[model samples]
Target: MPAPELAAVPGSQDPAPAETGTSRPTATSTGAPGGDAPLGFTGAGTGEVSSGSPDAAAVEEPAAPAEEAPPSTQDSPVGSEPAEGAPATREEVPTAAPTAPAATPAEPTATPAEPAGSAATTSEAAAPAESTAPADSAAPTDRAEPTDGAPSSEAAAPGEAAAPGEAAAASEAAAPTDGAAPTESPTPTPGPRPAPSPSPRPRPTPRRQVPTPAAVAPAAAAPSVVAPVDAHDAAEAAAWGRVDDDGTVYVREATGERVVGQYTGADTEEALGFYVRRFLDIQAQLALFEARLAQITPKEIDQTLATLTEALAEPAVVGNVDGLRERLEKLRSAAGERRKQAAAEREAARAQAVAERTVIVEKAEQIAEQDPARTQWKQSGQRLRDLLDEWKTAQRTGPRLDRPTEDKLWKRFSHARTAFDRHRRQYFSELDATQDQVKAAKEKLIARAESLSTSTEWGRTAATYRELMDEWKAAGRASRKDDDALWARFRAAQQKFFDARSAQNAEIDAEYGENLKAKLALLEQAEAILPVTDIKAAKAALRPIQDKWDEAGKVPRADVQRVEGRMRAVEQAVRDAEQAAWKRSNPETKARAEGAAAQLESAIAQLEEDLAKARNGGDAKQIADAEAALEARRTWLDQVQRAVHE
Candidate 1:
């Protein structure tokens, strides 16, 4: 028999449940039935882990120390006894911690005080000894320090004292060996007195023990503080972890069950319930992570995934471990999807940025290519600058386009802006030069006009003013505003001179009206000579009329050109007739005319001969040329004859 921590009741058999040493969080023992009681978790350290995945949860490194331990969590009914046909076994429940000082070995008694270190059960049936040791869970063992130098088996021989360092098989029953005569086993030595309340007689268990009842409540003063899990977590706890009769705790995994340390608490159910609550907490964390999946980056997800992966690998918890892993896998898949979605979004943004840059470049080019003569320089230039600003803004805020694409757009935009600036400067420079020339020319004209404004030599001055007005019309315009002002000054100066001339003419105009009427009558008489057949008569008649026109003279200023022009027409007709008459009277002139007519007649005769030769030779172009030359010569001969006759 081993001195286990779970101490037993005085006499009734059916082995007592175990006591375990676990690094659980601080808790207040509920001391409920089963073995270890439900604990009120303090949440100060490890026991603060919820009933579920304890190892997987983020918790403080410090493990909670045990608060209290009652000898028996199970309350024995009054007058209860061992089953009549059942084996009379003594379950050695562990009563003290492994760190407790070696118990003072006590004298033998009918019902021994169970040792304080390890747990053991001695089956003393009437049949030969048969010991049952369950398949051990990987859960850690709590053993006592050895008193003897030699090692011993789990079931000691009759009269042997409880050996130290021997772990009692958990959740298993024991009986005498088959065919061996029944032997009465020595009673175990009384060990350290365990302060315990009375407990019910434990039922005999088979090799594979059935599940135990819920842990009974501990004394109210039980020292450990345990955080309470929602009662709903118990089902989840059962799904992942279980406690053997000897108090070995295990967590179920996909690969099979593995140890998660012993549950030194009240009972199997309470132990599993504690870890189940922890699993729920971790599950909560998963839910939160899922909620934040959109906001967090893929890298953040990877880190969290790695952390959760490590947590789930060897967690101290009870729940669906495989389910948690599945959740982790789902999270990973979601992260991948998020990465793809984000990439797509970035690509779309980049494309939009590229399009925007292209628009800026195109607009700048349009401004640059406008005709400098017609361009609205101020507005167009400002628009280019605005486009540049837009480009900068897009660069700063929009997703990055490929370097090559961005650079290409920038070059185009910059080139266009530069070209536009150069064009604007050049256009303004030329306009300035042109405007300077116009101002200079106009200034000279204005100076000349101002000097001429006071001239009173009416006839000569009027002729000079006509010349000045003609020069002004020949000069091109200046800028509208400057030209308009300059023109007004020039008109005022001219008008002043014209007004003086007009006033003087007003008095003379009546006298000039008579002169104008006389000139007009003389013009009619002279113009009648235009159709004259007799050269001598036309010349003699026009000479008299022109003489009379000269004497009449001085028409109104407005009528002067009109009168003079009509007189000139008549004089020109007379002069033309006289020149012809004079030429006809010259001996040399008649001789030349006769000679030219005779030559043309002779040429026409030669052309007729050439035409006949061309026709004979079938040369179509030569024949046509000969015929044209003959016709021209004949026409010239007729004109010479007519002139000589006239």
Candidate 2:
């Protein structure tokens, strides 16, 4: 049906020859109805249809008159050539008629046939064009189906094209419409229109090129359309990416229509595990550093920091950079506090140590100035040791201190202790030597005194022994053991000498007893002569007794006084008798002699002359004879004096 209608339009004549740009005769050109008849047909091509000959034109002319004039009522479809005479025919047709379905013969080619019933009313007014043609021909068949019941559907096609030409067209038509039914078949084929299905055939249409900046502008300008990524997840992925074998994810600019980025979660579990382990490792390292910090003195801070830095650089730990950064902040805060405290502690410890050391040093100087042998270095050492013990114990239990300062103080304390010990030892050693000297001197004295104890030279030797005892008393004390023994020995020697002298004194007393008895008898004879009457006779008699008394050996001290008193009485009697006789023999001379002898006669006349003569002659018998003669002379002289005086 489509082939003959295409043949009926003069513009569709000789379709093959028109495609080839060659002229042919119209009568035999079966693709179109007339060749050069100029029937005002507006369709795809006029030049091709015009190439047919006159015979072909005569046979197809009547059919052309039927369809050509009707189709000429509508304007040309887009990209179709203008009919040579159709613009004038298009003007002759009333505007309302061209809009009517019957006015458009080419409606079947432009619209689908699904609603063919509506075309009957519109085509009735224009029924002559189809009636003049044969009922069974392809042209009438083509027109009858699309126009009979679906005339409104046919008019809808040309109405769409005319609507755009209207200046006052509805504003609703300007807006984009997604579900509007096809106003007319896409201006090419007229058969059953395929449903406007979404094509799966990949369009080879080249995409319109856009600049990178322009492509990115839409996303940048409309940030709300794009969701934000999780920061924590990003950080975790980044950290894991550092140590994991999988690559990392990061945002980049969009290129053309594609957004740029990476997918670090290629090995999600392993990368996450690596990140977790690195975090734990960082924590462990931080803990170790903290523990070490507790032990560190102020001086060791640099070394500790260096060690921590070295540990942090390990590949195992590098993955935990964020954790490291967090820990570093904490460590820095703690370190600052620790440093402040450590500095304060160090200052306190230094001050205390300096004061204590000053005291110790002063004590040491004092000890050094004193005599090592006599000084109380042991007591000083004990005090210093106690102080040192206190310091050491404080270091163990007290607040933290500087390590270097602690070491220096300990060294000084140890040195001081050594000095104290050295001095103490030297003192005791010298004291031992002094004691030995004293012991030796005492031992020598003891030996000398022990040897002298046996000497017995009475007076001279005893005097020498007394002198030795005095020397011993004056001597210094010996060592305790020797002093006691040596003193005992010296005392024993002196006691021995004194005991012998006492014995000799007793013997000398016994011999003096005999001498005392003989002297007593001689004294009795002298006392008998004291009462004699003659003085001259007594004088002569007492002279011999005095000599006897002198010649007698020493008497006992107890008897000597009594013996001398008796002799004095006897001598006085003899002198008195002699004085009486001389008075008788020479009266004038006797009176002068008596006066001169008054004070002397009593004591002088008591001496017994004979006994005294016997003592003087050293003859015991002679002393006895003199005593008898003196007694007789005293008797005779007393008689003569008495006779003369009468």
Candidate 3:
């Protein structure tokens, strides 16, 4: 009994009750009986106790009588003697407690106490040798714990440790003893069990040595005391159940398990909504990124570098990782080009503004430089006003300009306009005064011309009028009404003088009419002398006629030419007679006359000679007759003078 109890003690420091039996023999073969095995008293073997305990002889006493006849094959109690040449023994109890009673002697009354005691002693002596028999046998090494001496305190009750070895014994025991009472047995000595602390043990059973699926199935089907689960196990259990904070469950039928709900800071509904929103946001961002990538596809790497540079320049969030990276890459190439474009635009705008400002300043300066005294300045002033209006209108509608420049330009323009307006107004006012003076001067000149209109000295009055007219012209423009009235007055005065002088001349012409008739009668008497043949008589009569003509007054202005022509002819006859008488009386005059006649004859002869030469050359005969006539006249005059002298 002690040997079996001793074997019931677990050999290992903390032996699992379920694994104790299977591991015992091999553990014992390592040479230290019960040393290498689990120390649990739940499944101690008889041989193990005989080898481990010095008191095996005494402990085996009680089982000697019952097992005396089957000494060679019967299992021994705890605390038996060691056998020679036998394998070392383990302290694990067998799991054959239900079969133990059948292996015991059937008739306990028929057996003598001395023989039973001696049988127990002999069993103890043979325990070590019997323990090796199972190892040598070809049967499975794992066995059920013996009920005869199993430690009730160490091993689980019949329902516990329902592993294969123990379960088979239980089924066998249940078939015949269904209605029998479970016998009360002494509590076996306590043995060490595996650590009861739920902390994970580092040492694990080798996978190959672990129970096969078939072997573990029977154990799993049986009811047994389950070890308390650890936190990790509880988590795994929760995962299997698909339990979440929001109480949602998700099962996966294919896996025959539950899908764990993802851990979220909030409840299921809220978390789901958040995730949905996040997913949509991510999708939207991805779409935007794709669009941006397309826009920059020409130089993808450069575009990405540029984008990254831009992203780095600004504040950004962690969520913008992809965008930031792409942006920086884009910036690498695009930065210079963008800068150049921007700079060019800036410069162009600046130049345009400067050009506009220069035009404005130049216009204002031109206005300032204008001479206020000139009429052209007045036109310039008006033009400046127009320019100012244009400037103001442009300020309201033209291109954008810097405020300071606009203000400065406006100031210059306003100043120039103000000065011009003031000067123009002052000039016009002074000109009006000058015009008033000119108007007074013109009025005085008109009055002076009118005063001289009735003067009898015609030439002197006309000369004064002419001088006033000259003065009037020399005077500048007067007020429009005054100038017109003054000119009219001056013309009226000159008309009055001319009208009086014409009337006086008409009266004088009427007086000359009577004198004209007397002169005409005398002219008729003188014209009658033309038919008289006595030269002396005609000459004497012509002298009287000329005297009468001189004594007679002028003829009518219209008949003056007729009367004078008749008188001149009568006078010419008298002169011709006197000249003829002189010529006839003077020989020297006749001689000189003859001499001129001879020179004329000589000129005529020379002209005839030339004419004859021209006739041979087809010259005209008319030219020769003119030369002959001229010579004959000269001879006739010379002869008449000679006859008069003789």
Candidate 4:
């Protein structure tokens, strides 16, 4: 059976070559396919054009047709070249263009069948549709142009030639054309077609991996056919590509057809369908990219945009690439805004980092500025180190700061740390010197305290020790380990001496305990001498008591004040009584009293004489005066008499 002829596209001056319907697109990035593999979209759009895949070549021995006309009634597409003087109604006609190699029927030969697939395409060749080809389809490399000796005109006339062994008897793809509307041809009715039975065969290269075809479709005259394809997909794919009888595949774009790749193991529909899927994959990639716009950085977006733009510049898949390019342009515009946002975010982060580093520096400065004498060097030093660590961490991981700003902050921080360290060193140095002086002073004080500790003069020794303790207190301190050891030694010396003193004092107190008791007994006896009412008796009793008190000897140091105080009280009482007695018996005082009494008596006698005369003369005033005088004289006389006798 001979391959069928293809109808011409509606707009093209020439007819189309072998091709089939393309599949509709149903995949998208918004609603992705149900798998991790992004390119293999399985949706309504996955339906292949026409009869699934491109037409594969059917090989046979070259045999010249004796009939003048072939059975094919359809018009010639790109590579139509019939046998010499062959019938115009032939089922299969060689679609070789005028520039194609003219056939030499005189000498026939055989060419091994090359792997090929159906050229699935669309009938509306004016505008391209989304392709359903596999994602790895090659770039458009259509061989239908005149530059390749395959002119973009009607298929070769009845006498035109195709490639060697490629006869018009069963050659040419039944692809739709842009030259005219598609008309029904002698093809398999649009229905379910049997799946192609594949037979593995050796291949030279691993270009496009598709199994070799061993069987043909129900249409014996058609070069090849694939599994059932959608009519709509077939119409779209017609605008994108076509297949040659030798199983060569090409994708059609605005820049014209460029040969993409070849997989001659299948029919024209499968071959064009392969490129269509490639177009779909590109769409999916774009959708996924757009979806990821939020996650990627501005720089990454620019990089990816460049890559995508480069890819779209000369895309391999068959589809409406203009739309993809337009979408990419929109993405580029959005990327500019993203870049601005990223810049703002970076600025905010950088400012925050600067503030944090400043805080660390300020804290270090505070520590450095503290008074070395009062500063807690251990804790403050640790804190300073922690600040430094924080500063380093910010430098390594945080957003970069401007050079001047970073340098200034680093200088301040470094200076603060340096100052703090210097202060610490200086303080320890001074402390060492001061501690040495203090240790010497304390050593001398300890020696003094030890010297005084064992002295038998308990009072003087204790007072000296108290003075030593005061000097020790004023001596300040030494290093901790040295101070502790020195203090223990001093305390031991003081304790030993003091222990001996305490034992001696205890014996003395015991001996004096008896004296204290004896003094107390004598004090009671002297006091019993009734407050010196009888001065002589008091004097005699106190004399004996004083002698006894003296004989009692010294009391304990603690009881000395108390016992002596009580004994003195008794002696003082007795002395007071005796002094009163001596005052009463003094010769001058007695004579003064007697003389006073005598003067008063003489005055009374004179008054009595005046009174007697007044009485005899009956004078009331004189009698009253005389009576008062006599009374005073009598009182004076009694006192004088008593004084003289005492």
Q: What lDDT would each prediction earn against the true structure? A: 0.52, 0.40, 0.42, 0.52
Of candidate 3, the 10-residue stretch with the lowest lDDT total is: 132-141
Residue 499, candidate 4: Cα error in Å is: 3.0
RMSD of each: 20.6, 42.1, 35.5, 17.6
Candidate 4: tens digits of C-alpha lDDT, residues 1-646: 1222211111111112222212112111111111212233122111122223334222211111112122232221211111111111122333222322222211111212111111111111111111111111111111222223333221111222122112212222222211111122222122222233252211111222211221212111243423343556445744577767644556666666765433332466655665565565566668878998877898788777775775565544456667778898898888887888889999999999999999999999999999998999999989988998899899999999999999999999999999999999999999999999999988887777777666778677777777777888889999999899889878887787789888988899998898888888887887798666888777877787888888999999898998888778878877887887898899999889878877877887888888899899898988898898788778878878887887
For candidate 2, report its TM-score: 0.29
Tens-digit per-residue lDDT, 1-646, candidate 1: 3332221111112222223333222122121111111111111011221223212211111000112122121221211111211111124222233333222222122111122232232121111011111111111112333233312211221112222111121111121111011111122222232233243211111212212211111111112223344656557557677777645557778799866443443456656665565456556667777899888876788776765665565555578878977998898899899888878878898888888889889999999999999999989978988998998899988888888998889899989989999999999899878877877787888788888889999778778878877877777777889889989988888899999988888988877889888888887788787776888887777777777877887888889888788777767766787787787778887888999999998999999999999999999999999999999999999999987775
After superposing candidate 4 on the true structure, give the runs of residues whose Cα lies further than 4 Å from its correct spot. Answer: 1-269, 450-454, 519-551, 557-646
Query: What's the lDDT for candidate 1?
Result: 0.52
TM-score of 1: 0.42
TM-scores of the models, in the order given:
0.42, 0.29, 0.34, 0.50
Q: For model 2, how big is the CA root-mean-square deviation?
A: 42.1
Candidate 1: where is the Cα deviation over 4 Å? 1-234, 243-250, 258-278, 285-304, 456-646
Cα deviation at 183, candidate 3, in Å, is 84
True lDDT of residue 384, candidate 1: 87
Worst 10 residues of 4 by lDDT: 120-129
- Model 3: lDDT equals 0.42
> In order, how many clashes per candidate?
69, 69, 66, 95
